[model samples]
Target: MSDPILRLEGIHTDIAQYHILHGVDLEVPRGAVTMLLGRNGVGKTTTLRTVIGHWQARAGRILFDGAEITGAKTPDRARMGIGYVPEDMGIFSDLTVEENMTLAAATGPLDPARRDRIFEAFPPLRTFWRSPAGTLSGGQKQMLTIARAMAEERRLYLIDEPTKGLAPAIVSTMAGALRDLKRQGASILLVEQNFAVAKALGDYAAVMDDGRIVWAGEMQELATDAGLQERLMGLSMEAQ
Candidate 1:
């Protein structure tokens, strides 16, 4: 296999006086979706923030495509081809969907081909092109945020809990969009708690506990092993 597109080695982060992430080691292989799985408050989100420079790493190194980016600024990281969608789905409430997408383009105008691809992935984006982002439903807002990240080409995407609080139908739509991205060979580091979504989209899975990775394996293996799921994520059969 090729070298991972994103790697975190012994990463530690602190929020105020509290230590949130303790020595996290993770890898997201090229062209694969690596699921960062854990219960709430286990530092999964902190790890993503550290990677994208929203939270500085107190220690350890972050590598993107073999270059050390531990000290890189957030904009530098984004310029280096890291796309991020935070848990809050950072959309401009007053802006139209088109305006929000235009702002996300790294270079000049959005590439026509990329715009078509994004529309294909989330057709609602096309339907609500001129609508205020705030006027859209929760699911449409989520789609807009994801589409904004895809407005231009990106080497890696750091997405946090995208399906949170959405209806099952919307979750399925989001999952299908991610699946299309996977087919298009996009590399993603996804932090998700919904086991169903994880099982649907993860190529590899890493389970975190108290700021440390406790298990790493194939997604299918983790999905089928209910006992392991129960122990690692406190998941019940129904949850799976």
Candidate 2:
């Protein structure tokens, strides 16, 4: 396989007085989606934050595109081609959808080709082009968040719990959008709870528990092995 686009080695993090991530090691290969799966409070979000510098790593190295980025600021990481979509769907509530997209295109004005691609991936973005982001439904806002990340060319995407609280139809839409991204050769490190969505988009999978990775392998392997899934994640395909 080609070298990973992103790698985390012995990553440690703390939030307030509590240690969140402990010696977390992960690899996201180029041109594929790597699902970060775990029960809540296992430090999946913290791992993403540490990658983008939202939470500083207390120890260890973060290499992106073959260079160490452990000390890089969040904006520097963004400039280094890492796009992030936090779980909250970080859209500007008071701004128009167009404006939100424009802001996400940090390099310059929104490129027409990029805009076309984003709109094609999430059709609601076009329909609500001029509407305030707050006016959009939960699914539309989620689309906007992912679209904003796609506003510019990015080598890697760090997405957290994108399917949380969405209707099944919306989850299906989100799944399609991720598939579109994967087809375009975008590498993604996705933190997700919905096993069905994970099964659909993940090319590889990692299971975290108590802030450490306990299992790493092909997504299909985990999907088919009910005993493995039950042991690592406490859920089988039927439960999911």
Q: What CA RMSD would you report for each candidate?
A: 1.2, 1.0
The top-ranked prediction according to lDDT is 2
**Per-residue lDDT of 205-239 in model 1, one digit per residue for the tens?**
99999999999989999988888888887766336
Taking all chains together, each candidate's TM-score versus the true structure is 0.96, 0.98
Tens digits of lDDT, candidate 2, 135-211: 99998999999999999888899999999999999898889988888888889999988888899889999999999
Cα lDDT of all candidates, in order? 0.90, 0.92
Q: Give the TM-score of candidate 1.
A: 0.96
For model 2, the superposed segments whose C-alpha errors exceed 4 Å read none
